[model samples]
Target: MRNRKTGFILVEALIVVACLVALMAMLAANQHSSMRETQDRLRQKRAESAARSAVAYVFSTLTSATPNSVTLNDNWAQLGGNGNQSFELGDLTFRVQIIDANSRLNVNVATAPQLQSLLVDQTMVDSLLDWRETSTTPRANGAKDEYYTGLETPYIAKLASLTTLEELLLIKGWTAQKLFTVQTDVIQSAITQTDTNNRQLPLIDYLTVDGGAPNTRANGSTKINLGVRGVTLNQIVQLGLTQAQATQVFNRIPFNSFQQLLGVPGLTPIAQQRLLDAVTFTAGNRVTGKINLNTAPSWVLQTIPNVTLDIANTIVTQQSTGFTGLSQLATLNGVSPTTLPRIADSFVVGSDTWIVRAYGKSGEIGTAIEATVVLTNGKLQIQKWDRLNTIGIPAWWNWEEEPTSTTAVGTGQ
Candidate 1:
């Protein structure tokens, strides 16, 4: 009874309450930590599942669309689910630029009006023309000789090859930013020659892109001729073919009917290989009279008669829910009666189509994982991935971080 009375003292009671509060706090802290860990693991698992689901969509739907190749050159429909709900895991809303890798450049194969219709800035077209002209010292419009000569490095000694698209920064009036705007759909890599010494050497044996056009020019002006010099071929005839030589030479025949070339016997192993490696054929415009609206990218849609990016993205988003035809897009949020006709002639929905997916996890710093799939050639091939920079990603995967944008972006968009 005495001890109990002592324990019931006001100070002791307050101490007991304080101890209880601290113990409770410690237990709560441990529970919170456990909860957070569980939530994080769930988030990670969900993200990974989303990625797999996205990949599955590409493999199934996109691959079935085409047997030849997958293209990332145009519009991408919504990949999975719809509405605010569509914005869930594996919910991919983005634009893909789908075109035959071998398709002729709209700017090059196009008539002047058609080139204008292709909907790129007039200035970009002008610069392209300037570069295509047979001028050694081609100065882009609005740029002077000093500007070309004033490069941090000397302008390429001669335009033996196209400088990468990124090199266009050296062009007058083209900033790095402007290049990004114009070249998003385009791929840039060195079109390296196997042998620079031989004029008719076999060129890019590994020409990528769908519909690999033979001798297609990067500028849509010049053509690559991967062949033996006619003169070299003639010289091969002067040397009598040993039996082994004849077999090796015959193996490298360029023409299916070599009966005509049989009279000339001098084809060397190298020359014969060149003939076999070369592709002289050209690719016609598969996109022809129709502009498949469903497949066109937002940029391509913007090029449509009067649609802006907002309207274009809107049209693209709406088309995901099974766009039967271009006309059906009139029901979209921003579509007006007047804009309908213009869009109709410009876009085609639900024809030859592919899907591009961009989904990733976000952390305090920024985007953690991102993937890009080009649904072409009837398979979902990863065009690029930017998460972690390598292995898990490819070099071309692009991630756009939340803009630190204090100022609004320009009208150029």
Candidate 2:
């Protein structure tokens, strides 16, 4: 048989070897793919488990409170100082900060200047003011048909009503970066509907006090200033109006209803709404407060003074584990006293909900996954959970930390 044709031809042997190699490669690749999927699934399961525990912890702590001791609407001062409680999971750590949104400017009710300060963009501030001023009733200046047609089409002449904070994106010069830089809550929406044409603009847009350019001096122009300041409110009672008059006007505004001051005398249409936007009257002096450990954006977190992006991110990543109280922040390598103080007022621990967010490992991927949680009645709940790597997030509740320990070594006994 000619020695069995020398077993096989070189070409045939080569082909068989190629086939074996191909099969090995396929098997190796399949194994790797399966392992990667399994690892991801495990990571997700672990993260979800941590989140549930965090919620349970939040509810247990708050619900166990004595009656009248901790009400749903209790303010910062009422909550007292932060404790040492913290939540940790895997490589994650979390803390809580309850803030009274009323104390801060409500973008919906804030004025142009207040918005400007919050945004820190002169052009954006000026443009918004110009639009509001020029767009009077039907035929406004800044954004009339003629003005809008000049820009890139399909041009939206004017926003009928700003239902969400993201609407600012339509306006010229406003970018996602610029809007988010100031920590504006894109999840929040505002509707400024003054039934009558001449009706006073809602004070919701004037959340920040009239500051910088349009500020009111002791002896200046005739413009009635609308600013919400501790000093201004105090002066309103002591100087502008009598104790009785101020009381009457003040009484008109109850919990979360400071916008009524738009009708107060001595206020221009702009000033009235500005003040209204700035003022938020809660039932008590203090109100519920919170900081989304996960969702607190960079700018807001950076406002914590020396907090670096890395530190903020670390805190965010650790959020699922849970946070007991405020001090755990010091555990971060870079966080120091200076940063803490600057950021302390900007954040609160132990009230309400939170969202933890992080970028994907690959820079090309955007908006990896953002976890949202709601803490009510002391329990933390996941209101919305999403992976924003694909479609953008929509506005919706509609409405809508950690540490270590030390012990004593020496004993007196």
Q: Which numbered prediction scores highest in TM-score against the true structure?
A: 2
TM-score between candidate 1 and the true structure: 0.34
Candidate 1's residue-wise lDDT over 222-287, tens digit each?
322213323233333333445555454444544322223322356543433333222222234223
Which candidate number would show the highest lDDT if scored against the true structure?
A: 2
Write candidate 2's Cα lDDT for 330-395 as tens digits: 455565533543443333333333333322221111123444444344444555555543322222
| Location of the lowest summed lDDT over 10 successive residues in candidate 1 | 200-209
Cα lDDT listed for each candidate: 0.38, 0.39
For candidate 1, give the lDDT. 0.38
